[model samples]
Structure formats: C-alpha cells, structure tokens
Target: MNNLELTDNVSAAAKRDIFELQKKIGAFSNDEGAEEAFRKYRLTRGVYGQRQPGVQMIRIKLPYGYVTADQLVRIADCSDKYATGNLHATTRQDIQLHFVKLADSPQLWADLEDADITLREACGNTVRNVTASATAGIDPDEPFDVSPFAQAIFEYFLRNPISQEMGRKFKISLSSSEKDSALGFMHDVGLIAKMGKNENGQPVKGFKVVIGGGLGAQPFPAQTAYEFLPEDQAIPFIEAVIRVFDRYGERTRRHKARMKFLLNDLGLEKMMELVQEERTALKNKVYPVQDIAYSWKNLGERVPLAKEEILALADAQLEDSEKELFQKWLATNVFEQKQKGWYGVSLRVLLGDMHSSTARKLADVMRQYAADDLRVTINQGYLLKFVKAEDLPALFKALSQLGLADPGFDSTADITTCPGTDTCNLAISSSYGITRALEVMMKEEYPDLIYNNDIKIKISGCMNGCGQHSAANIGFHGSSIKNKKLVLPALQVILGGGFTGANSEGQMGDKVIKLPSKRGPEAMRTLLDDYQNNAYEDEYFNQYYARQTKNYFYQLLKPIADLSEVKDDEYRDWDHDELFKTEVGVGECAGVMIDLVGTTLIEADEKLSLAHEMLAEGVWADGIYHAYNTFITGAKALLIGEGISTNSQHSMVKEFEENFGKTFYPEAGDDSKPFSQLVFSINKNEPTEAFARGFVGKAEDFLKNVKAFRAGQLAENSIPALQELVYGQDS
Candidate 1:
C-alpha cells in the first residue's frame, strides 16, 4: 500500500449523495492506477475495506499500548471530527474508528499526528509498541524498574530491518516482579525478576528468563531459559534470547511460527546449545558492550521515606465509609516500599482508561505524591511509586475526583479488554463496552457474588481471541450466523478459560448463546446473576463453567435469547454454530509485558541501547509467526465471499492480481490470495443478508476491512537501521 508517490485516483468515489450512499468502486485493483492509491495509502492512517458493500473502517495505532489522556481526547475529538464519535480499542491495544469514508483517513491521521500518535506501527509487520507493567516502579515489591527498558525496546525495535521482516512477529515481555500478572510465562520471550540473596548474601536483582510461550491454534507455556542473569546482563541476555528464536525457529508451517513451538520441538538443552554458541560469538564481536552484560543496576542508592508517610497518606485518602474497604484494597492492591515510610499504589481503570481531565489530574497527583516516576503495565493499569505516607490521602482524593479511585484496584473491575465489534474489522462482539456493562450489571444485580475472588469475566470480539476469552474463568468470543430463518447476534459463551501462576488454557465453555437485542446489557446481567447466585462453594468462575457445558448455559439463557425484538433482523444476534468448542491459538500477550528480570524495566533498554540488538545477531525463523501470517493470508482468501466451508476449492488469485499491488503479487493458491480481497467481496446492503442474516448486514462492512486494518502486523516489522540507530514514536 506504500508504493504510491501520491494519490490521484483516476477512478474515485463520487461525493454526490444519493437517496442511499451506494456505489461500487469495482474490485480494488492495483491495476494501472495503483500507484496513486498507494500514494494516498502513505498519507492516511488506514486504507479501505469492503467487509460489506459501501462501507469502510479506519484503524489507529497505539504504540506499546501507551496513549496519553490527551490522545484519548484526540480520539474522542476525531470520532466527532469524522465518521461517528465512537472508538474501538483493540486487543493489541490499538484503537480503531469504523464507518469511516475511504477519503477521510488522511485528515484523521493528520489530526492524530498533531497529538504525537501515529497510525503507522498500528498494523503491518512493524515492531509493535513496547508494553510493560502499568504498575511498574510504583510497586514496592518490584525487584527492578521495567519502564526504561520497555521504552528503549520500543524505540529500538520500531522500523528496525531485522525486526521488520521477522520470520514471524516477534514478541518480547519484561516484568520486574514475580506476581506474574503480566503472564510472562506465555510469551515468545518472557523476562521475570528473580530477587534473592546473591553469592554475597546482600540484596541483588536479576532475571529468570522464560522463552517460547504462546497461545493460538496451538498453545504452549513459556519455559525458563536462564536464571539469575544479573541486572546488567539484561540487554545481552535478551539479545541472546532473540538470537536463539530468530535462528532456530520453524518457518514452513503457518500453524507453527511462534517461538514457543520451537522451544517445545527443540527442547531447552538443544536450544541453549545453539544460543550459547551464538552468544559467545556475539560477545567477541562487541568487546566493551559484552563486558557490562551482567552488572546489576538495582543495587544502587535506595529511595527512602518516613514511616508515618504511608500511614498518613493512605488514611487521609479515604472517605469515612470507604476507608476500611479502600485500605484492604490498597493493602492487597498496592505495593510496600523497601524504605520505611513510602509505598506504591496501583491506579486501576476500566479497560485501560484514565481520560481527559483525570489524565491531567493523575499526572499532577503523581508528581506531588510520587517521586516523578510511574510505570505502565501490560494489563492497562498504572502505578504511583515512592509516595510518602502523608500524601496518600490527598492523592487518593485527587484520583477519586478523576473518577479513578474505584475500589477495584486489584478487584474484578480492574479488567483488560480489547476494542471489539465497535471498531475493529476483525472484531465480532463489543468486548470492552460489554465488559463495562457487565461489570456494572453485576454491581447492581449481585454485587456480593462478584466480590468473591475466583470469578473473572473476559470477552473477545471474534475468534482471533484478543479479549482472551479462552483464558478467562467466564469467557466470551463473538460470532455470528443465522438461525432457521432469521438473522441474529450471538456470543460463543465459554465457561472455563483460566490462567493462573500454576497452569495454562483454562477450561472453555460450550454453546453459542443469543445476545439480547435492545437489552443486550441485561442479557449479560442475567447470566452473571445466575452464575453468582448459583455458583458452587469455593468454585471460581471457570471452575463453575467447567462443571456446566455451553449447552447448559444456552439452555439457561434461552429465555433471554428469545426476548429479542430487534427491528433490523440482521442486527439480531442468534444462530448458534459450533462456537462453544474451545480452540486456542498461538498468540503471545506481548513480550514487553512478560519478560522482567530484576525490578528495573529499563535495564534492558540501556543494555540494548549500549550493545545494539543486531539483525544478523539473531537468525529469525519461527513456525508460529509464519503459520499465523500464512493463516491470516489464507483466512483472507476464504473470507472473500465464496462457498467457504472449512474445505473449499475455489480461490481468489485472479482478484488478487487485479486488486493488490505488485508487492503482493499473489500466487494462484489459497495461501497467496491476499485475505483483504475475500473480505471486500461481502455484499453489505443486502437487507436480507445471508451470512449471519441481519447481523452480518448490520456489521459485514466492518468485517471486510479486517485485512486492510493491519497497520503493523503485516508490513511494518522491518526497517533498515543505520548500524546503531533505532526508530519509534513515544507517548
């Protein structure tokens, strides 16, 4: 899409409004006029898709999942600025604006660019934004600070050549504590901090490395690659891990590109054998840099405070009635500092939001109470570190004014969700909105039920499973199809998808339950109420789900499902398919989140900056990344409106040649036909849409744009670095 020097489409859409705004641009061909289209592609944050006829979707990138309060304001503004005032947050932490006209992406990008947010790395194969503990530095229990390293990696990896054309997407995670909230155990490479007595018996910090963990068509847990690599060696250690993955990973299978599968197939002994040799050689090539690879940075000067500060600040922050509950939440949710009088508190938000005036307030509050530092966690939570006891009360009040001092600090509402159905073309359900609605529903209907520790409700828009429904105790995956004679909306309800420190891939529920039309929010409320009230003693949400299959849930939910009076039948959610089956895919949560070795997140950054992560240093080939990419490419072909059973004979190569540019000279096969074409082929305006009845018609146009929406996963992973230079936009 980037080949165009300028966009001057000879065949463009007519702005003339008709009784109905409808027209066919014909097949999106890269034909003679392709260059101009490519030209416009560069200036715009997104391209057009035909998930349905006469509709388009726009994607916005959020680097490393970092969006400032101002940027969110920009999102709210741009939503008003163009299309509709609605934004969708993605599993990748990117935001998407749907219903966008094909002609408006440029202005949208220009507006977003004004806020230093770029749609560039939002998709394509580019190095994605670096993620870390939202509670970094502020968590007193953290052994090392990870923000610097995550930032450095984000800076270094963006547009780097070696990273750009990765055999498959490379994911790296960094965490500083052992709480394992970041799920470091399930990433391409996970770094966890291991704090203990060193040989000298004094406090020391370093990492416990885990490699090759991912979830997808095939799920695998990350493994320990190394232990006790001092804080200093973090950069070289990660570089070594990358080299191991890039060199020895699989390349032939679309289902096997992830590093986790590699670790499983090769076994750690053999994997390390390859890595050790590579590391030895790399060290020799970089003399001075190699020498500092094992130094521990956390042993530096400690930040101290008075003991009275922690007590006073926390005591002062609470309202009379909320003080007790707030204190308990704080005790469990906040971290105790090593210093006598300081503490770090977690500022949790619903689905990664600290909006508008609150953003400004939080920053100010942190500055006043904290030591000018904060950490962002992959879980979309924030941290305020080094607060004196005296300031805690006021800080809490300030945060409460911002509507952020919700009691769910570590409670269920401190949830993580991807923007689904609302904006993403790939999305099938409204994950976050629904999550919020559900949270509220539970609060109103069965507040005490959710207070129990074991139940967590997670939702994903579609099969890509961004919301991680497959891992939640009560998970929801969005899907659509028609019933005997009607169109409908539905969610493949999963009962038991759980992830804890002990195991992986929680039990999945069965049956596709219909969503309530006007009372969709009420439908979830019913399910939650039923579960909360009927749950077995000591049974967590997933455990209860395991006891009852999706079939049972559906049977229980049939009453609510039958209540739909949706006018546009197509928008009605129903027609349950084999959606209840639990199938996990190979997807890493993002590396910057899982890999923490020592409390310092930036140690890797300093090390990477100093040693420089080289392309040749790591030979990249992973079966999973390749498989996922190829799967997406193949999936795209099937989506092109055809007799698309699991098994199909026809292909879309003919259309690919006419539509996609030479860069994507699709071959005559299922794998070669770009998926974008298949999605665009969907007929949108069909009031009696056949795909999923009215629901597909209501949302089909959104689906067609899924392929075109990949801002960083497909094409942006590579960039030619000038020996020691790095690239990326920081929030």
Candidate 2:
C-alpha cells in the first residue's frame, strides 16, 4: 500500500504516541558568532483604527448560506483567479480570503459588488460581517424563514451612515428557526425570529433579542438583554444597541469596550435603560430602514419552477457521466423546495479553501453544468441548490476545479482559519502560516487524520479571535517575539474548543509552547511533534492538549533537541526580562508605522535592535515602515484591551525619551560610517545637517559627508507641487 493508504489502519493513539516517543529527532547547528534572527511583521484585522495596516477580511454575504449556482461559480472563479482560492467559510455563513494584496483588493471587491454582493466594511472597525443560520426554511427545527431578515440587515448595513462609525467592531447573528446555525450567544447581538406575542398580549411576528455577547481575548457569554420585540422593532432595537455602544463604549482601550464589557460594568438593567434612552433619541431622528411587505413567510404564494423542462432535459439529454451517481446525489444533495420540482443541493467543501486552477475550470463547467445558480455556506461549504439530478456530475466536476467538492463534509481537517500573521497586522502569531506548515505535517504524519472525525484545528492571528479559534477543537493565536534575542513568541495555544447548535463556547487551549516569534513554520513543527505522540484513540489534538497539564507537556519539551542548521531556535529568548533590558553606550533602536494604505495607527514596532535611515526619502525607508507596522499593532501596548491587563507601557514614551539621548539618523552613501558612529558624532556635540525620521524619532544628519549623498537628491512627491515653496523654501 502507498504511504497514504498505510495511515488509515493505524490507531490514533499511535499518532499521539509518535509525538512523545522521540526525545531528540534532530539537532540545530548553532552558528557560533553569527548574526541574529529577527521577527518580520505584525498587524490587526479590524476597524478600531481606520486604514490601520490590517488584513482586509472580505466577507462574501451568503443569505442563509444560500447562493445561486452562478454565484457559487463566480465565487469559485474569484477564489482561484483573485484570492488564493483557499476560501474560509465563517460561522456567520460568509467566505473570507487571506493573502490578498492591497492593490488587488478593490478589483476583487468589485467582483462581488458586480454581482450586487458587497465588501463594504468586512474589515476595519465597522459593523462586521452579519451571520445567519445554515438551514433556513428546510430545517425541521426552524421557527420561521429568516433569509429575508438576514438579507435586509446586509442591505441596510452596507456603508450605512451610523453603522460605519462604531466604538468597537460589532457582530450580529440570527437563527432561522429556534434551531439556529450561528452561535447566538457568541454574537454581540442575537436575534431569533418567530411568530410571537407582544407585552400587550397581542399576537405578533417579531424577534427575540439577546445582547452583549462576544468571544475574543475577553470571552463573554452574551445574556438575553431583551426577551422579545415586535417584528418591526428588530432593526430599530439593534440600531439602538449599537448607538449605545458608540456613546458609552470606551474608545481609548479596545479591550474594555466590547458591548458585553460595557453591559457588565453598567449591569444589564442599566444597559437596557441606556438602550431605551438611545432608542428614544433615535425615534426623534430619521431612521434608515425601508419598509416592505412582510407575510410571516409567503405562506400562501406558490413559486413555480421549470420542473417539467428540467425533467425532460435530464431524463433524455444526459449522455455523459454515471446515472446512478446522479440519482444518489439528488437524494443526498437536494433540499426541500418551496417550488414544485425545485431543490437545493449542498456541496460540502473541506477546509474552506479552494485551489485556483480548479476554480476557473469549475466556473466554465458551472455555466454549462447543473443549475445555473449556487450558494455559499457558513460551514465553509457551498450549495448548488435548484439543480436537477442529471447535471450533478457536471456541477461536481466544475466544483472539482475549484476544489469545492468534498463529500466528507464536517470531518477533521476541514478546519477554518482566520487570516493569520501572513496578512493580518493584529495577529500575535502567523495563523495561516502555521496552518500551511501543519497541513503538510498532519498529512505526512497521519494522512487519515481527517477520516477520524475527532480532530480539527482553527486559528486567529490575534486575540480579537476573527477565526473563531475560541470555538475550534485546536486553536492557535498569532504571536511575536517580545525581544529580538528571544526565540519564543507570546502564544496562548488553546485546546478544548468546539461549536454546536446546542452549546457554543469552546474553552481556549493551553499555552504548551510559545510561538518562535517570527519563525512560524518552526513553531508549528514543534506543536505538531508534541501532538503526534501525546494523543490517544478517538482523541483529537484539541481534547488531548486540553487534558494534559502545561507542566506535563513542558517537561516533555524541556530537554534540548538537536535540529538542522535551518531550524528556528526561538527558545533563546522566552522571558519578559529578555525583552526589556537597559544598557548604556548602546543607543535604543525602535521601529514605527507611519502609514498603512495611508494613516497613522499604532506606535513603533517592537524596538528593533538597530534603526535605519534613508537619505533618499528622509530617514525611514518604505520597507522599514512596512515591517514596523506588522509588529507595531501586535505589540502589547496597542490593543490595550478592556478586561485584560496587558501591563503595556505605550504612554511611557516621555520616560523613554528622557532616558535615551535623541539619536542621529544615518547617511545612505557612506559605508564606512555606521549609524552608531554617526549617533556618537552627534552626541559629542559635532555640527551637522538636519534631517527627518518619518515623524517618529529625532533626526540629526550627523554625517560630515552629507553633501555628496544629497547631490543626487530625489524630489518629494508632495513638495514638488508647491511651486513657490519649492523655489524659495518660503524663506
């Protein structure tokens, strides 16, 4: 049997045993007297700071996780052609892409927009992507069809005036019936639509509300803020809650500002009072909703379908592929149709991502294949609803191009990942990066890991928990080195994460190992190595990691192991003390982000061991600023979350300036004079030309040979437009 086939029969315990079975599998060759390794970048993926360098988390709206087959085809085409094709299905029933280059984002976004889909405030600190249940009218457990409400909210929130400016990012989830696809309690606001009664005991169809729930670094189990409100009041009530958050929520410290935090501190009663006050004020102001007909579900109208035509085409015209296969798909993939002879077919996608080459060809096949329509699911899957049985293989093959065809849906390794450090600025560790590494590792170590339904891995780059790592079976947070000399990054590797319609909050895993700061691939390998040997039968990585004590795992990894010269050795710097050390004669080094797309967001990236200066463009280089932004947002000082005491020292800048003498900037042309020497020359009170350091630090052109470098000077883009200023410097 091939290696892949060989892994199927091995007990899971054997996989777990492999992790602990070896003490030192390889040795890392230390380069004695060599240069040091440093972490590369960091950034956030939210809207707390407009234009902050962050991952542009695009949420493709899936109304009830249902899209037309054409929509699905376009999504697949875009996935491979625009994004990496590894689309992630969010619990909210949206698809998210990572590694999206900044320049291409607008085009990619336009694709969705062309279809009348949106990319309006998926990222940034606005009302984030809205969520809805997977099963709408068809679910046996549903109360009433909520596809309309979900559609309404999506339409209303797109660049809405009031929704754009929020104190903290907000999330909204709705259940179609009592059995909701989304974790209602985990959202900032939960809405359950139903046919109900009002306080006056009048029969009404409306929504039941639950407010103040969120999951992140600070997980809060949302409580029911309001039991029920009439149907007409749902949108207004939600608006009121959001306005209250904007008015009362803390803006300076993000951690303290989640609606739940505000609700908790104010107490639910007080929160309701405030909500009432906000609602009253909003009533006085003009509302943005457009009222349309609502019939508790078009219970009487029967939507007709081209059923006879579909049967005529399928029964006689299908000349390719297997007929029995098509029949079976019709049985398993078809959904309850409101229209006669019409049905929705669900096509599960494992891992929420698709390959491009596969996606493009699928686009062609979809146009010619099954139903001409499809839909996306929140489960990181999609549905080719409204399709006839005869077109199943063609639809399947087209999807196969996009790699969306995974029959073993919801099994292990169909893991969802939040755009990690690879693209996100706020992530603490490289979530996607590690995911890539772990994918290879898991496939190699246990090819049949997915076949065993017990395992899963989810990751978020930072604590805002965008990937919903909190609810994954194995959750990983992005992290970075607090110190350049340190080997380990600050990681809170959580375990015991899970999600379900019955119970939603997944316990966070333990910090078995710190990320090796920037060495994402290496850190992932270590975690996988540990997982291979320690797990048991029917034991997924999350459960095993949760059950084992931190000490137990630490002891196992304590001994030094030999590694290849290429191995990442983040273990050198793991403690806080190593991160912050004071020394004389050695001037401090710092990096900060000046602009991201175009705006000031965070403070300096973790202090670099050395600072660079570019005369061609003032002091800071474009590359340096890019690198700085990556680390800056993730540094403990920026997030300053509410309940979590970061012990960050952002305001200590004055103290820092006082302790370290303002250093001099460097010269590009001179190779003999290093930055340190130039600083020393300035410190000795030497005369020199002046310069700028991108508005962050003090800059003195401490070099004696500045004239030669400036001789080939490049004109500033902005300054060139000022005719009089450029001609005379306004002197």
Candidate 3:
C-alpha cells in the first residue's frame, strides 16, 4: 500500500499524536527554546533522542510480545526504509529501530500503525509495554493463559489520562504460571495466574499480584499486594494504584522517581490505603477481560503436514550428528505444548538483533510452520507456537537454514546485552562487544552448559539494568576504572542473583569486583572454573555462591581488578580502535526532567482540553483525571513562576494553597477548605457525569486564572524569576 493508504488506516487519536510530533519537530528547528518540552512530548509517543545528534530511536510497543508474521515483515520494511536495517529487540519485549532522522519519525509511526502497531506510551513516564510469559497459551503448567489479561491492561492504559504523564515509568508483567517465567518479581506490578475456589466451591480465575518492584542502580523485589485477587478486579486495582503513584510518586528527583522508591518511602499498607481511596473514582470496580486477538480459538485453519511422511523424511535425510543435535535442540529449545500434539519452539537470537532480510525470512517460516502469533521472548529471542510434533524436524531444518536454530534459548551460552556505546547515550562502556567475547568463550570452552538453563548471564550498558544484569546468575554492567593517567572501560562483575525457588523470588546480584573490559573473558573463565570444580553436585550457581561467600570470590578475582596489570590496549574499550574516554551523556531512560514554567502552563492547557473532550465523550473517570492533572500542572506552573519548586503532585497541591490561598481563595483559607481540598476531591468523589462536568469546568477556570496571574506577573519584571526556576526536591 502507498503511504497515503497507510495514513488513511491510522486511528484519529494516533494521527493527531503523529501530527503533533511533526509540528513539534518543526517548532524545535525554528526555536531551540522548545527543546525540553518537545523532548518530553516526543518520548511519550516513543520517539527518543539518540546519543548521536540529529538522529532518533523509535521503540515499538508490542503488548505481551505478540507480533504477527505480517507485522514482522512490516517492521522489517520500516527498518530498511526509515531506520538502519537492523531491528533490536529489547528485554522488555519491545523492538527498537535506531539511527532514524527526527524528521522521518512521524511518517515512520504512521506507516507502522498501518500494521496495527503502536508507538504510544512506549517510553517516558507512562505505563510501558505490558509483558507476559512467552509460553502463556501453550505452557503445560499454566492455570490459564495470562495473555488476554495483559492485552487488556495494555489497551486500557494506552492514551489513558492517568498514565499520560507520571513521575517515572511503570512496568507490569503477567506470568503464565507460578513458575513466573515473565519475571514478575522485577516489575512494578507483577501478576501470576492462579486458580482459586469461591464460596460456592466453584473454580475461579485470579492472580497473585505483587507490586513496587524494580531494577536499576538499586533493585527491589516486588512485595505481595494480593495473595489472590479475582481476575475482574485486576485492571481497576492497577488503575487505583497508578492514581496514587501519579499523585505521590517523586517527580523532581529523577533517581528516586520509580514506584519502588515510593513504596519504600510510604510502606505498603499506607500505599494500599491510598489505593483504596482512589477506588471510588475508578471507571470500573471490576473490569472483566473477555478475549484477546491472538487467543488459541482464533487460530485460522491450516493443513498439517502428514506425520508419517515428515518423520520418514526426517529418518532418511538426517545424519547421525544432525540427529544428535536435533535431540539437543528438542531438549533445550523445544517444549511440548499443553495442546498434546502441538509444540513451541524458541529461536535463540544472539544479542537480540536481527537483520531485516533474515527477519523477513523468519516471518515467512513463521507463516508456514507456526501460528501467526510470534512472541518476542523476554530474554530477547523469538518464541514460535502451535508447531505440530511431526513437523518439528522440517521446522528445525527451515530455521537451521536461516541460522536461527541456535540451541540454549535462555541458558548460560545465551547472553543478553544492551546496545551500550553502539547507540545508547548513557553507556559508559561497550556491553555488546564484551558480551560477544564472553559468548564465544562459553561456546569454545564450555559448550555443554547448553543443558544448564539454571544459570543466566545478563549484561547491561549501565547500572540502569536495561539488560537486566541485576537479575542474572552472573552479571556484568558497563563501567570504567581509572588508572593514574588514563581511564579503562571496566565490567563490574556481579554474582549471586536470580530466582531462588519454585515461586521465582528475585535476588539482585552483588557486585564482586571490577575488571578491565578485555579481561572479561578471563573473569568468566575463572568464575566458571571455580563453579565447575568446587560446587556441590547439581547445586545452582547462586547456591554455590552463597557457600563460597562474597569475600572468597572477591579475593579470588582480586588479581584481575589490579590496575597495575592493565596494558595499553586495556585503555582502549572493546571493539574500538581509538583510546577510550568517558562519554556518558544525560540519561533519558527516566524521561526528561520537566522544566520551564511557561511550558508547564501550556501542558496544563492541553490537559484542560483533554478533560473537556473526555467529558464530552462521557468518559467520566478519565475526564476527572484529566481535570485533576490540570489542577496539579497549573498550580505547579504558578509555583515555578514564584521560584518555589515542588517534587510530587501532592506536594504541589499543598504548596499552591500555602502560597496563594490567602489572596485567591480567602474563604477557603478561613473556614471552608484550601486549594488542596478542591483538587483532592478527585479521589474522594465518585466519577459521575455531574462531578466530571463540574471538575472539568473548575479546571478550565483554574488554568485561566493561573495564565492571567502569569500575564500580570510578566507585566511586572518577574519573567526572569519565572524562567530561571528549576523544579526539584530538596536533597
């Protein structure tokens, strides 16, 4: 189809967002004053500024990693046409296309939407891509598939007023079963499928919910929010929880802005109390998830290849070594589906990157051999489902030809690494280059580790854990160590992290030592040798680590940490010919810090407009939330104009009343209530039509008053004070 045809298929809301991006890009080129505001605006729509100037990275959100064969082909075409011809799959199950010009992004977003793909809320302080276990539908042990529920959450929150802007990003994961393959313990909100009995003794579907988990410079395990929350209440509960976060979560201090930090500051009980308060304002108390687009019942008709014919061909065509390898592949990469005769196959994607040509071919293979739904694995691979048992050999042969049939899907041999210095602005060292070296070393020296899936090796470009290094049995995050005159790229070796038991409890890795990047392979060999020779039989890596103690491993690897042994080549980072220099730029992973008082007022106006629109559409709760944000944003803007910074929305409300209540709302300051009470009424009142309309009207008046006050202040000589204020929390 032509670009116009593609654009014709775009949703009205999506088209408006894309057009806004296009306009913002033009505005930025003409006036640099729009940079910070445009940065925040573009990120919410998934356009990210890259390390290199004049280029952008676009992250495409695929809820639960569900992508059709046709969708894959479209993504490949976009990569070739707009971006570099490489598609990078991220750990959170999103695909990223990097090195695209900023001017091309709006069209890129438009083209992808033709395939029913979205870039909305893919970045920024919003609800990110909702992930689930790749084995959701086909897993033999799952109580019921979590895919539908995950999809429901993703849809409900996309463009929802509550999550449009927040202190920091939120992540949710739904695991197929208690095995927690989706790694729920590391998410802001994690749900594990559960089968429970009601008072009538009838089996009911629900989830064991966990909340406030995260990984970054510091990692926190999710705490149990509900031992068994009925499935219908999932979305509503999450909405209430997000409402609390949007109000109270840290905004100015970027480091402490995640939900986990908020949970730390306010204990779980207090947070839950706040969540209960917001419940009255929610659109639904029980939003039932009915069905998903990629449900099993919707798999289109397909003629299965005859079992006898395929097995016979397999016997005749396969050599002995190939047969042995096939068995190993079956043992590691393939699993019997819950649908007796069907199977699921995993293709180990090295470093989570695929060339467009190979991706197109893989899409073809997916169409012919597997179901249309292809799940991007959390470990940065692809999971193909609904393969018949008889077609295994033929499917394997097709994948082998494409060089995607690598064994050890999530084992030690399969290493996960972020783009690092190759593309990411925050990377201090090269995670990709070191990961490749470590993978090669593991294969050449310890190929048998493919049978060991218990030990996972993860690498990240930085301490933010994009590669999830903190969740690996053996982990490495990019860093640098200084020697007298020169700085050498270093890997901070971490051990004793991963899931512990059947419940999949998360353990953040402990930093053991720092070694020069070139010696990473040597460090791996030393750790592996020690684990291999001294561990109790069948003991997991973390178990062995506990027995040896952190000090023992530290002393053992202390020699490698010595800067005296560093060579001239050590000063050069891996895969680079030039001398290394620290080039870490401002990290955008937490989203841009909101600055500029006038811009804040403009954003408040936008929220006021959305409130009016939603109120007109009769979306009461959403309209109310938009109105609520309008109050906070307007108050924040006025406070910023006075050179008074506020951190959280809650703080901003109090600050507004304290500063302007006597002058603006004299009656409220005396006996009735303050500005805080008016705004805080959002959570206290139910979201009825009358309340929503009144709230939206109040928001409009508030913004109008704030803008008038700002105009009066600017009429005086207060423009410099208004513009110079930077909003943040006191350290």
Top candidate by lDDT: 3
lDDT of 2 by residue, 124-169 (tens): 4467667776555545456566666777776665544344434467
**How well is each residue in 1-731 modelled by candidate 3, as lDDT tens digits?**
12332457789988888877787787787884457777888888898878898898999999999999899999999999999899899899999999998888888998899889999999998999999999998889999989999999999999999998899999999999988888888899999999988889999999999999898888888999999999999999999989999999999889899999999999999999999998888999899998765645655434544545555667776766677677678779988777766778999998899999999999999888888989998999999999876778888888888888888899889998899999889999999999889888889999998888888999998899999998888999999998898889999988988875456577788998998999999899999999999988878788899898999999999997887676889989889999999998877775665566778877887898899889889899989999999999898887887888878999988888888878668656355556887899998888999999998898888887887777677758666544333211220
**Local distance difference test scores for all models:** 0.49, 0.48, 0.87
Off by over 4 Å in 1: 1-122, 196-204, 227-234, 240-256, 261-277, 280-339, 353-358, 368-371, 449-454, 500-731
Which regions in candidate 3 have their CA more than 4 angstroms from the true location?
A: 1-6, 293-313, 319-321, 501-503, 669-672, 718-731
Top-scoring candidate (TM-score)? 3
Error of 3 at 296 (Å): 4.5
Clashing pairs in 3: none
lDDT value, residue 75 of candidate 1 = 71
**What digit string (tens of lDDT, one per residue) describes model 1 on residues 1-731?**
22112123211211111100111122133242233223222322244342343445556655435555456566767776675665544444456666676545555655666666555444432344445555554445677666566655555454333343233556666665775555565567766767756678887666777777665535566777777666566665565555555544543343565667777877889987766655542322221122112122233344554435555656655668766655655554555665545667776667764444455556667656765444444445665666655666676667767766665554554455665554455565456656676667666766554244455566666755666665565566666545456544456655555553233332333435645333455656666667768878766565666577667777876776663444553353333222222222222222111111111112223222222222122322121122223323333332332332221112233433344424343354645544444332221211121322322222223222333332223345453231112112330
Model 1 weakest 10-residue run by lDDT: 13-22
Off by over 4 Å in 2: 1-112, 177-179, 193-195, 198-205, 283-351, 355-357, 360-373, 387-398, 436-456, 480-491, 500-731
Q: Whose lDDT is higher: candidate 2's or candidate 3's?
A: 3
